[model samples]
Structures are given as structure tokens and as C-alpha cells.
Target: MSDKPNDLQKIRSVADYQFGKGVGEKLFPGGVKIVHSKRTGRIRHVYLEEKRLATLRPTNGLFSLNIAGAKRIMKHVKPQRLWVRVREEAEPFVARGKSVFAKHVIDADEEIRPQEEVTVTNEKGKVLAVGRAMLSGKEMKAFKRGVAVRVRRGVAEEVKKETLTLV
Candidate 1:
């Protein structure tokens, strides 16, 4: 018999399988782990404490799954890539024949502050990109820009304006 265990045929629930067999006890010794049997094979869902950390998606043979928190930290601290999207259709507003307005606006976030990192999203709440804020939520409404949102990665759709209802 080979050192490799037999291919898992199905995984029903947390109670149905051994702790380390599906998720590997070495990686998650005592944390809550969830696994789902897929057509291709077994998929592992790992959590640390109460936060979801990583997911093992279906692969051809073997692969590694990086925890979500680690991925988030890497993206926030030392992003390997950057992206942004134009939220709305805008034309440059010119004053005295000089360009005076930008083509996009960073929507207000309730807790946003000047010079803080923030993720820009569309009306549908899909993240368009991430950038440093040049102005506060209140200031963005009045100021033009020195880099309101740096446009790390531009999405390819026109942002739809949302209507807010006050109760």
C-alpha cells in the first residue's frame, strides 16, 4: 500500500470524519474545521478561533491553501498588485479653459479619515479598489483632489448611483 491514504469519496459533516484526516491536524490542531465533499475531491474549510482563515478549493492533484487573514495582511501591508475602478461617468469640468474636475469620486465611508487606507467600492458594495484617502468623508464632498482615491485597480463598469432613504 502507498503512503498516500485512499482518495476520500464523500464527507458528510464535522461528526462524520476524523479531525486531522481531511483538514490535517498539523495545520489546525484544535480549531474548528469544516469540509465539504466535492465532485473532484474533498475541499477543506479552516477557521482559527472564530474567523475563517482559508479554503482549499478543488485542484487537479495537490495544492496549498493560504489562510485568509495572512492573505489580507499581505494585501494590506505589502500588496503585490493594485486595482481600481471608475465609479461613474464623469467629464472634466473646466474653469477658464483649464481642466478643473476629476472623472471619479470616492464615496463616503462612515469612519473614513484623511490619509487612512480604504477600499473603494461601487453602489452594489463590490470593492473597486483600495487607496489612501486624501480627504475625510466630509472633505471629499467639497474638495477636488490631490489623490482622493489613487485608483490602484480600475474596474471596467460604470458605477451606478444609489439612492439613500432617511427614516
Candidate 2:
């Protein structure tokens, strides 16, 4: 019983350290469910009822943000974590479900590393997609070719569901 609460606290702490302040609270609201693996009993998924928010990587034990989690965190935190900002010209394409190109990236969080999960946004900070970073932030700004973010999910109407239902 005590272990469960402690585990949840550790998860929240990790989210705060990884993303930013207030992000954990936003993503893991009260009543959020932490799904554990059947074999290992380790947290495998974080969910708000039926909406999956993130997955805990078994190799590194780090949380990888899903589309729903990205959207939730984007609403609370500024674009300073693992975030990439693209030009308005790229908004339509990104929102329409396309990978972000380095040529279109106007700015990005300097802390972003290659292969890390990131959220792509427009100039005004509208989240367009959640994806994995293909290049470092410096590389994304310096290079004109190559993919910056390999979009895992896009901001289509189907993706933007309403408030998460508590489990």
C-alpha cells in the first residue's frame, strides 16, 4: 500500500525533472491510473482512464510522452523542455500530420537531444505534433535538410479528444 504511493511520487518527480514544473500535476491528475506490467509489476503505462498518456521505457525506465500527454503538458508548461518550434508556414503541414523538417524549424529547446521525445509547435506555441527528435537542437537550427522531428502523432480532430475520463 505504501509502496504504491511512493512509486507514484517518484513518477511525478521524474515528470517534473524531465519536463518542467506543473507538468506532472497536469499530466497525472488525481485518479490517474498507472498500469503495471503483468510479469515485472513495473509501471508500463500511465493513463487517464482510456486515454494513454505515456509509456515507461523498459530499457531506460524513462517516460516517453504520447500525444495526449504532450497536449496536456503543452497547455501548462512553456516551450523550454523537449520542444521544437516551427515556423507558421510549417504549421499547416505539421498539423496535417507531417514530420517536421529542419528547414522549417524556427527555434527549439536547446536542451533537446537526438532520439528524445519532443513536441512540435507553431510560432504561437500551438502544439502540432508529438514526436521523437531526429537531430539535436543545434543541428536542427544549423542544418537545412533532414528531418527534425519524426512525428508519432499529429493534431487532427481525431487526436484532440475532450477531457480525460478518470479511471
Candidate 3:
């Protein structure tokens, strides 16, 4: 929290494991702030320049990405992992914080597993929302009913941050 090197290393290592290799450094560059839980005094939220980036889940010990964090991944995480590209008809709704249905998914990373963090993108690679995948990537493509991703934050909710992005 106080520009601690250990904190940075821990978060970066977690990011690499959760997203992919080299993602921790990119997602959380220098100067980012780590906020500890008031009740637990444990690292809880991560921020950069006053904007929240991600939250460390206490139950799973995994990072739940904010829109800002998702943008960083889209920009720096090469070859794209854990992405769910949805249909045109669903883009608007997804951008408004709606869950992505299996029938609407155009394509998804086959390696994605259930309960993992995922970014919902448009056809042109625009990040629309960030969420936990309710189904595996293969299931999203194969199934026609049920939810694929339960969106946490949508781009529409953070229109001001839209310009600060990695499309």
C-alpha cells in the first residue's frame, strides 16, 4: 500500500498466474495504489491515479478486474486470453452491464474455464464489460441457453474512462 515492493511483487505474480505471463507488470504499472480492507487490514482494492483497477477476492484469492484493469489487459496481454466476443445484437446490452448469454457469444477462448475472469469484447475488439465466466469457453460456444458471463462492470457505466483505453 505504501509503494511496497513486496506488494507489487505479490500482485504481479498473482496477475501472471490469473491472466497470463507478463500481465501483472502491464496491468499494474508503477505508482499504482493498493488499498487494504478496513475491517480485515488485508490488501483488497488496487488503484491507479484515483481510479480503481481491481479487487482481490478474499474467498478465491483471485483478482476481479475493473474496467480500467480490463483495458490494460486488452492493450498489453498479447494473443488475447479469456476473451468472449459477443454478437452485435448483444453488444449494446452487454455494454450496459447485462450478462452475456451463450447464444450471443460469437467466439471464446477455448482454454477459458468456469469461474474465471473474462472480458467481453465486441467484434472489433472493443472491451464492453468485465465479468466472471459462468461457463467454460467451449460451453459458451456450444450451448444455446443459459448465461455465459455474469458482467460486473460495463463500459457504459464508465463512459468518462472510455477515452483512456486500449482498443
Best of the candidates, TM-score: 3
Candidate 2: tens digits of C-alpha lDDT, residues 4-119: 56666867877887777767777788878889999999889988877888888899877888777888887766645888999988887887678999999999888888988899
Predict model 1's lDDT versus the native.
0.38
Model 3 lDDT, residue 139, Cα: 97
**Candidates by lDDT, descending order:** 3, 2, 1
Score every model by TM-score. 0.33, 0.80, 0.90
Q: Clashes in candidate 2: how many?
A: 0
Model 1 residue 123 CA deviation in Å? 2.2
User: What would the per-residue lDDT of candidate 3 be over residues 44-82, giving only the tens digit for each residue?
Assistant: 999998888999999988899999899889988898899
- Please report how far candidate 3 places residue 103 from its true position, in Å: 0.7
**Which model, 1 or 3, shows the larger lDDT?**
3
- Please report the TM-score between candidate 1 and the true structure: 0.33
**Candidate 1 lDDT score at position 112:** 53
- Which segments of model 1 are wrong by more than 4 Å? 1-86, 90-103, 153-167
lDDT of 1 by residue, 69-148 (tens): 32343343322111122344431111011211223553464345655444454444444444445666555555665455
